[model samples]
Target chain A: MKRKHKRLTFVGLALLLLATAAALTLSAFEESIVFFQSPTDIVTKSVSPNKRYRLGGLVEEGSVRKKDDAVVTFRITDMANTVNVSYRGILPDLFREGQGVVTEGFFVSDVFTADEVLAKHDENYMPPEVADALKKSGKWNEMSSKMKKQGHVLGGGSQ
Target chain B: MLHRFANPTRFLRIASIAQPWIAWATILLAGTGLYLGLFNSPADYQQGESVRIMYVHVPAAWMAMFCYTSMAIAAGIGLIWKHPLADIAAKATAPVGACFTFLALFTGSLWGKPMWGTWWVWDARLTSMLVLLFLYLGYIALINAFDDPARGTKSSSILVLVGLINVPIIKFSVDWWNTLHQPASVLRMDGPSIDESMLWPLLLMALAFKTYYIWVLLVRIRAEIISNKIRILRLRQVHG
Candidate 1:
């Protein structure tokens, strides 16, 4: 019995150490994470124009327009506020209107110029930052309609 | 020929005979791969020196997936046939797969920082690969979770079999989703998009890693089987 107890305790301690290490690494990575901000937040906060940040929300219906071969402009709206964005190069297949996206870049001359854009493949999927932002705004359900339209069976029922 | 080595004693004998040959091949292939990667292969016109990471990252990723598939198949054999050695093979592969997954992720991140301009991206390919690493760790954890080794083996086998879905997901991620990660070049319907000079070394390194996996698996499984026999003997001695 004592021998078995010792082995069990050793295994338990090893697991605890492993879990702690994983958590520490995750937390460290989490701190560097910049949550996507909506245009509303950007407007209200008057965020520093030079600082790099991420903006995520739905690409507003009929807001995308091609400016040139190398430049394209669109609006990202959280349904309450919208920010104009300009991007260069070929867009991802999932970069359709009314889809959730996250872009990391900087604000230049009152316009958000994205250097990188991200879109999800699955229907119910929302970027982590977008989910957190909606939860904080108390409007995640209202926004999740987009998710529902995309066939998010699990998230659809919560609303 | 493959079935012949399914017997543990036969496997041990064959492995002992083949060990030196495989070891030499591994060394020669790896040495040549490194030399070609370092000196002969042309740098990407776009990516420059960072492209060297492809030599490591691609092989590690391939081996990570290969090891998991091998493990899951071994688990299946163990569950269905109650093959004594199959469970040992499955259990022995967990840490090796985990290490390969870690290497793939690590080399990928190093490559990503310069190429994609980020250390990490939640791109479909990247995310599913990350999930694979987690699955490997989960398998390792679950296998040791129970006091009864048999219980642990059975449960973890189920997990491994279920987690196999992530393999296809990783492979088709770029096609299924919009991701920063590039689509297949070497294994595509079209001929390899890569230059021949680079392709040869990468293929050789991949073979080297595969042989390395077989070598390590044999050594570890043999150790496990021996340890299990020792454990049974010790238990009998205690009871006697």
Candidate 2:
């Protein structure tokens, strides 16, 4: 009986140790967690200029400006506000004016510098985090109508 | 629960009756899910045709974690109560879980090249998911390493419980780690951020994958129970 008790206690302790270690590792990475902020939040919060974060909204129509080489400048808008973004890379084929886009980077003065950008390839798509941010901003209803019309605007092609 | 279901005759009787329905559901749901995900859903405006990968990748990823979690819970029951059925359940689940994890990684990589511009990255979520796959492989190997089935089950049960720690880590890795993977938007405290048009399909796919896992797991567990019975019966016939 004593031996059985000892074994049970050992196993219990081992499980506890593993759980604690994993929780610690998870919390340590918290600073790296990036949450999506709308153009309005970016404007109002005066978010730290260099801190890495995400900006998600529709690309303002007629705001895309292709610069020399791969460089491009555009504006992201949540209808409440807009932020300018400059990116230098091969843009995804789906990237266009007036489409949902999420970019990870931070603000530098008036320009929002993007290190990476996400472009959905389908009509029924949204980045899980970006969606949360939009719902929090009370702009999800506005986006839903736009998503329904996406098929009509994108040529109604399956590909 | 394990003791009541441990007897192979009892298990066989229950599983045999359920097997055909489980098989049919698996077939039906998988077909419907594939049709809707592939043919009906509209192509992403930005991703073009590649967005079709999401339907498969997301479902597979979800199953990978869900399978491991079920295995771990079975292991815990086995260890705490020495329940025979729990060990068998854990044994049956490991390979299936590993396969799902492998599929998730495979599909994620295929999707990543065009989207992230790289086939592999040390992004928190991706790396953690890879670790989960490795953990599943490790459990499978540990269980089969020994000649003695009881010894193998006992040792591997411990491993499964230890590996359970990784599940939460995987779920929160995107939130905690500064990695390329995006944070959670659909499962959140405030509410889902995605539009209903996109959210509904993803949710449907998620449910379809979950239901399919139960169907597959039940089938696999029944097979294991029958094999165990055959081994015991053969021993008795030879000795008699």
Candidate 3:
């Protein structure tokens, strides 16, 4: 009986300490916790400029600019609001105008200065993008109208 | 109250009855899941064929976290309530959870390279999940570190309790921190953001993984019980 009590006490103490440590660590890093924000989140929430973040949305059409070999500027949008993004690095091959993307960095004077850029989706298990495009142009109306009943836009075919 | 199942003979009898049923369910669910996931599912407007990786990758990721959470709970019960089968269940689950975590990380990387254009990133969701894999490895290693089986069980259970913090971190990482990984879509509060055509296969795959866990867990526990009998028999011969 005494041995059982001792074991229970030890287990109880360990759990309590673990809970305390986790709480402290979580509260200490509040800013680092906001992983990725939509453009509307940034505009509506008044995000601070100094904090690093991930900004994700559709890369705006006709907004991509290649000023130099490694430097690029573009705009990200959600069809509701848009945010300007600039980056100086080798862009991911999947990074293109008018696709979903995520950019990581801090804001610099109203511009999102991305340290890294990543495409939101990639071609792996699904059919190739070209096949999808071919299917879209041929049967877009029928497929989209079917999707419309479900109340959600088909991502790539939306625009 | 719980000592009713302390008898290995009784528990083994129950496990035998349940094992075959769980195994068959696993096969049936996986067959349907794969058919729906691979053949019937519509291609993602963005990801195309690469989106199919989610059928395997996401389910493995979910199982990795799930097994750890179950292990931690079993460890807590075994260590505190002194449940007989709980410790064996926890021990049996570690390797399976470790394997799932490894697959999740490997497949996630493979999918990432094609979609995100990088094989690796220090994103919170990915990194915390890596930490979970390490914790599973450490728990498995610690269990065998001691010459005394009871001592090893106690120490490993302690480690499992400490590592329980990682489970929540893994689940909320995409939401709590700036990560390259996308936020939750399937188990979201605002209903599933994924299209219904895609949601069916994902749910089926998740169910298949779950039934698979239950099937393997029973098999491992039975093995553990036999091993315990062997250990006891050897001790009796030495004493005699």
Candidate 3: tens digits of C-alpha lDDT, residues A1-159: 787788889888888888889979876875555445677777787768888877877688799999966789999876677889999988775687765688889988789999988886421222345446657688645643443333222122112
For model 1, residues B46-162, the per-residue Cα lDDT tens digits are 455666788889899989999999998888767665677788899989898999999999998887665445678865577778999999999999998998889999899878877
The estimated TM-scores of all candidates read: 0.65, 0.70, 0.78
Error of 2 at B189 (Å): 2.6
User: Across residues B61-149, which tens digit of lDDT does each residue of candidate 2 receive?
Assistant: 88898999999888877777677777888888888788889998999889877875556665567877888988989988898899888
Clashing pairs in 1: none
Q: Which candidate number has the best TM-score?
A: 3
Per-candidate clash tally? 0, 12, 13
Runs of candidate 3 with Cα error greater than 4 angstroms are: A1-13, A30-62, A66-72, A76-100, A103-116, A121-159
Tens digits of lDDT, candidate 1, A1-159: 575566446544654565566446544653232234556656777778889977766688899899757898999876667889998866654577766666789988878999887652232222245456668898866755644343221111111
Off by over 4 Å in 2: A1-10, A26-65, A69-89, A94-159, B45-49, B233-240
On lDDT, the stronger of 2 and 3 is: 3
lDDT of 3 by residue, B113-225 (tens): 98888898876788899999999999999999999989999899989999998888888665555466766777756566566677789889999999999899989999999
lDDT of 2 at A56: 64
Cα lDDT computed for each candidate against the true fold: 0.72, 0.72, 0.80
